[model samples]
Target: MGNAIELYDWNVYAIFAPFFAAQFFNLKHPVSALLATYAVFAVAFVMRPIGGFLFGWLADRHGRRMSMLLSVGLASAGSLLIGLAPTYSSVGLTASVVLVLARLIQGLAYGGEIASSHTYIAEVAPAPRRGLWSSIICISSMSALLVATLLGATLSTVLAKQQMVGWGWRVPFVVGGVLGIVALVLRRTLSETNAYEQARTERQTGSRPSMMRGIWQNRIAGLRVIGLVVGGTVFFYTWLVAAPAYAITVKHIPAPEALWSGVIATSVMIVVLPFAGALSDRIGRRPNFVFFTLAAAALSFPLNRLIQNKAWQLTLAMTIAGVTIALVVSILPAVLAELFPTHVRAAGIGVPYSLAVALCGGTAPLLQTWLATSGRGDLFIGYSVVLLLIGTVVVLAMPETKAKPLE
Candidate 1:
């Protein structure tokens, strides 16, 4: 439930990009409006690093349970604000401001939520099956995305184009806000991780956990997080955001078809995620990371070309890519958590992971659309390959942490 609430707003925005793009931006061309909307999306990410630091600090110093509760509430507030914001037609530039502010708040909440939640799970799950248990994070995220896409498909199928553009876009945000409430209620039952409690007691008695000291001590782990995250986040947002946006806008597929394609692809990925997590538990995280990077780097461009040729090809490409990426995403919680000890686990993971995601992940949709618009879409393919290659190197150098004891 906590994971679902953390990601609900993100998937909501990605799925409804087109409808809300028009509502938020009063541009002449649809593409220009989309770029504007994506620009706001990217801009909101600038706050992620700050959010990571603030929330990571809270988890590290106070408790993971409290941090999760606060982040979810903030996320719900942000979604509600976006749902209630005036359209450009109603309030002109003020509408854009409201939209941007709402996104910023969501970005902040998600940064903290991801780090804290992953840390919490890592500490609670059994040592031998940490990978499988931690994979629940990705499963939750994929489920949220699936729900968002299905909702979009349903709404687009039912509403006329004009009706969809008018008000249908707001429904998902309102729904996400409600889901957040459910997650909040569920999270109230969470207990503090024993690892964190032990660390906190130790700190209060004699030694205190310092964020700076933790980073300096685990600086190499921090760098590894950034390196691995670049490819992971870029590829993720590419498949998750750019592909569907391109299909609907550039390919001129009906909105319902495009949205349904997304639903099918993401649902397949969701099923694949836990299996990948279990596989990581069996074989180790490094091999899975290496396989995903090498395969994605080699196949992504060709698969992208195939997607441009046919709708079925689009579904196939997204599904394959989504599943492949799930291998990495599923194990990421365990891998990142294993890199740092409990004293700095949340902050160490949060800062580097959030920074990489903010810098690479958040801007992907805008960058891909702009590159495609400029008739250099192929560059995006090369961009993914380059990032993957870097990730391959990082994975190759990093030590395996499967079932490693949490510090």
Candidate 2:
């Protein structure tokens, strides 16, 4: 639930960027301002690796609950700052500076949140059902994106363009900030996982277990996570986060319509996640990943061709993309968690995973928008296919963890 709220706060910035870009940057032209907005969006990704390492160390050294508490508090503070950030008109470049600082905070928190939560779930779940349990992450994540899209659609429908630009864009940020407090409260009830407890208890009485040492010991496992995450994060952000904006900006689809289409597609994806996770448990993690890579790679250009400046077409494109995406995301956390022992699990996932995302997913929106603007959208589609194929190779190289025991 805390993950859900944190994602909502993070994704809301992407959804509302078209409306609020002019408020932060001096760029007056719509495309220019939008591009500039995406630049700041990528800036957050730059901080994610640092956040991931910092929070992962904290989680391993202290406890998952403590790490979560601090991450959520930081996220809430960031959201509130974004909600009340001064405009270009009021504070010149200071507005953009505040926006950057806010995103940096969020980047760090989200980086830690993913690694800790994934580690927590894999540790607590029964071995045979770990895949199914891991789907909760995807459910929370997709549901957050759905809610952000719904809220964006709702506001765009009710508010005038001027009003949306002036203040409506801030509503979701404020809501996210307040709800983050509730998540922090809920997270306080969490206990350390048994695996972590055991790992700590069995250690030599005199020596402090080093988080960095644990990560170093499992360096190979961390490398596997980085390979698997690169394509998954890039494709997910491209089709889910960047798709609707592409429709509205490049195809000239209406804002409300494009956003509402994203909501519907995301809703369907959420419904598919648990079933996909269960299937991975029944079969094996590799097959689901294989299917997602093959299917998403095949769908890239065909789905892009399907959108024609119509809401339903956009819906059709994203719905196919989302369902295929569900196959991978539903099991990915479990797959990554199963790679490392509990002693170094969080940091192992955090370091390499966050680095991959910062390099790929963080740049996806800007890359997609630029391709569309330059009339080279097909090139972006090709780029996605290439990444998917690389992911396929990585998935095949890794052993099946379906019945593997955590150390």
Candidate 3:
């Protein structure tokens, strides 16, 4: 439930970027307006590392349950604020400011939410089957995207264009806000992890656990996280956010068709994620990461080019990318949790994960749009390949953590 709510909160941004662009940005051209809005989306990510460290410290020192509760509340408020915010016509620049502010709060909440939720779930899972259970976090997030895209597609289908542009876009944000509250209520009943409790009880005499120091001391592990996340984040946003937008904006595909394609692709991922996780449990984490990174490097360009002219091709390409990406995302939480001691697991995961995601994931959509518009789409493909190559090198160097005991 916490995963569901957190992901819904995060995904609402991508699913509604077009509507927000129309409402908040006052540019003359539609493309310009969208770029500006997506720029705001990237800007919000600047807050994520700070949020990660802050809530990570709270979780490390106090409890994961408390951090989860607080993060959800923050996200809920941000969603509600965005839903209730006035349009540019009514409030002018203030509306855009409000939008940026709302996104910042949401970024902060989601940054923390990811770490706490990942740590909590990984700690509770059985040692041998941890990959299967940990994959649920990413699956829940993908499912949220599926739900949001389906709803957006349905709304576009039913509402007239003017009606959708005018008021229909607010519905999902409002609904997400309510769902966040429900998640908060559900999270309150969550029990503290025995791992954390045991770690606390067995603390070495005079050995203080410092979040910042822990991350710095675990610098090698932290860098591994950054490597994994950089390519993963870009792939995720490209498939989930940029692809749909590119189809609608560049290919001139109808909005409903583009969104429905995303819905279908995301639904496929929802099924594929668990299988990938289980496969990692059997084969090992390093092999899957290496395979996924190499596959992404090899396939990204041709497959991306394959989708350019038609909606069906776009759907097929995204679905393929989704399946490949699922292999990495499904096992990532367990792998990350296994990298650090229980005393600093959340902080360890949160710091580098948030940093890489903020730097890479958040900027992906804006970067893709800019590159495409500048007629250097080939360069963007090269850029993606380079990142994947870096990830492949790192994964090859890092030791496999399959069925490893969480210290």
Best by lDDT: 2
TM-score of candidate 1 relative to the true fold: 0.98
Regarding lDDT, does 1 or 3 come out ahead?
Answer: 1
What is the number of backbone collisions in each predicted candidate, taken in the order shown?
0, 0, 0
The C-alpha stretches of model 2 lying farther than 4 A from their native spots are 204-209
Per-residue lDDT over 307-378 for candidate 2, one digit per residue giving the tens place of the 0 to 100 score: 997899999989999999999999878898899887788888888998999998988899889988898988
Stretches of model 3 off by over 4 angstroms after superposition? 204-206
Candidate 3 TM-score over all chains jointly: 0.98
The order by descending lDDT is 2, 1, 3
Instruction: State each model's CA lDDT, in order.
Output: 0.88, 0.88, 0.87
Q: Write the per-residue lDDT of candidate 1 for residues 210-268, one digit (tens) a residue.
A: 79888888899999999999987889888865677778877777788888888899999
Provide the lowest-lDDT 10-residue window in model 2. Answer: 200-209
For model 2, which pairs clash? none
How well does model 2 score by local distance difference test? 0.88
Q: What is the lDDT of residue 255 in candidate 2?
A: 95
